[model samples]
Target: MEGLTAQAAIVEAPGGEFTLAAVTIDPPGPEQVRVAIHACGVCHTDMVMRDGGLPIPFPVVLGHEGAGVVEAVGSAVEGIAPGDHVLLSFHSCGRCTACGDHQPGYCDEFVPRNFLGARTVGEGDIRRDGSAVGGNIFGQSAFATSALAHADNVVPIDPALPLALLAPLGCGIQTGAGTVMETLRLQPGQSIAVFGGGAVGLAAVMAARILGASRIAVLDLHPARLDLARDLGATETADAIERLSGPFDHIVDTTGVPALVERAIDLLAPRGTLALVGAYPPGGAISIDPAAVMSVGRRVVGVVEGGIDPRRFIPRLIDHYRAGELPLEKLVRTYRFAEIERAFAASSEGSVVKPVLVMPAVS
Candidate 1:
């Protein structure tokens, strides 16, 4: 088989610069599959990697919000086959306690193994200079022409829907929805407050609506996004966080700023749960009112990748999008793969919501 040149947008180190470059992909060995990516989402995490929030080893592919077709399968893999449509999510070891408990995000060895960027498994998965590239970054690293993902991370998807639009379902969309659906599991007729109003926050808003929240309020610094929140399904929208004081049944803060997290908790009702899903800088911590927390019986929960298994959640999200209930397509701005630099710039400007990089045809 002829090898294909795989292009990956990678940052060489934590807090280092990044660029897109091509690399050669070897054939998949047993227990591995090579996916030709059709689309990869330029998520905030990509920016965070550039900013060094996540310590992904340099010279490693940085994308995880990915969807595409399986071009080749490893020998030992099962059920899923080549040509299967698939989406990739962050990686976790299945045998870990967290994975066993259905909390793979909290896998004990997940941080070092996934963030280090080389092939995660000791088995033959990646190769570079006769040395395997540390690849299992979140288990997928779906940013290249062909991503070598574990059978566990490469989830098969229905081929009926557009692949490009479905990429974000693995990360941001699932984050928000999972917070409500799996993490908080807020009951019906409850009230929820979603802060940020970007993709993650909007995802929370949409998920809350699906979960039947009676009162859903969205707060954002950007009025334009707040408007979109209203269009999406938010019962009320506010530009400033200070404008409202609430005892919300559930509060979701996708902003990592300490002050915002604190204020989000303040809005929570008695026995309310505050779900913080954003990435905070190293050594950063928030100060909450201990007295109020004790008196109000408030609890703060941190959500990672929206507390989900990609294989389980991506399908439901796709169904919601197909039905127009979770119309995530409306939030996306597609960019040609060649325009990746521009898309990254636009995402940073807060001008674009979800920027998807559509790979050119292989003709």
Candidate 2:
């Protein structure tokens, strides 16, 4: 296999605007596959990386929630072949203990592999004018029309489904829905309060409704999102967490706001659980009363990628979507790949829940 040229959205520096330019993509490594991306979802984490919230190298291509068709595979890859439809997820080292236990989200090399923008320091696969450009972000960096991904992060899916609609299942949707279905496992008749009625929170609302949760409350600053939350199965909606009466069986905080997290801990019912799914900047901290947690046996757990194996969980999510149980259409808005800036603006302004970039067809 030889290198291929593709157009990608690149950020030249911290807090930089994305520039669409032609770049050279390397062929698949022994344990990798190459994908011709059809669509990629814009996530808050992508904005976080853009604004220097993460310590990734610049001049990087960053898009993790991608869905596409496999174009090629390496010698060591199996079970996936050219023309297979697939969705990309976070990268994980298959040999790690967490991965051995089927929990790849907690892989030991997660930070270095997913955030550092390369497989190792100073080595990048994508290049421009012979200059190494940061790639391998989340192991796919599918912002490009093509991406190289680890075999572990690529899950083959049915070709009949719309890739644009299912793009977000790789990240935000999975995180939100998985937090409820896998992490908290909210039982029937239980109650849950989800903070931040964005894609993640709304996905949780849908999952909670599917699980038959008695009370599903969503809190968000935007009135429109709150209304959408109600329409998506949130039994209640509020602009502030305090306004919603709690003592809830489960609480999920997707805002990454320290103060809100602290407040949420106080509202957990006895022996209840709290799942933290948001990203906070490095060194972000919260003050918690140990006694408050100990007295009620409240549990707080940090979740990544909904604490799920995408290979398994993504298929289940597709099943729900097929049944019309998970209405992804309500949460997604598509844009042409060139409309990247407008997509970001829509996401930042809360005008769109999930903005998916549809790549131009290959000639």
State every prediction's TM-score relative to the real structure.
0.94, 0.98
Model 2 / residue 10 / CA error / Å: 0.5
Candidate 1 weakest lDDT stretch, 10 residues: 120-129
The lDDT of model 1 is 0.79
The C-alpha stretches of model 2 lying farther than 4 A from their native spots are 120-124
lDDT of 2 by residue, 1-363 (tens): 679899999999999999999999888888888999999999999999998889788889999999999998988899999999999999998889999987899999888889996573322288898897888989999999999898999999999999999999999999999999999999999999999989999999999999999999999999999999999998888897769898899999999888899999888999999899988656888899999999989999999989999888999999999999999999999999999999999999999999999999988
Clashing pairs in 1: 12-58, 12-59, 13-58, 91-138, 117-134, 117-135, 118-134, 118-135, 119-134, 119-135
Tens-digit per-residue lDDT, 1-363, candidate 1: 545667666656666555666666777767777888899888888888766677766556667788889988877889789889888887776898788877777777778656766453434444444444546566677666677777877879888878888888878888988898899998999999888877898998899898899899998888788889988889998877887668799988887778888777678899999998887878997888898788979998888888887778777888888788899877899988778778888888888889998876654
Clashes in candidate 1: how many?
A: 10
Model 1 — TM-score against the truth? 0.94
What would you estimate as the lDDT of candidate 2? 0.92
Q: Give one clash count per candidate, in the order shown.
A: 10, 0
Cα RMSD of predicted structure 2: 1.5
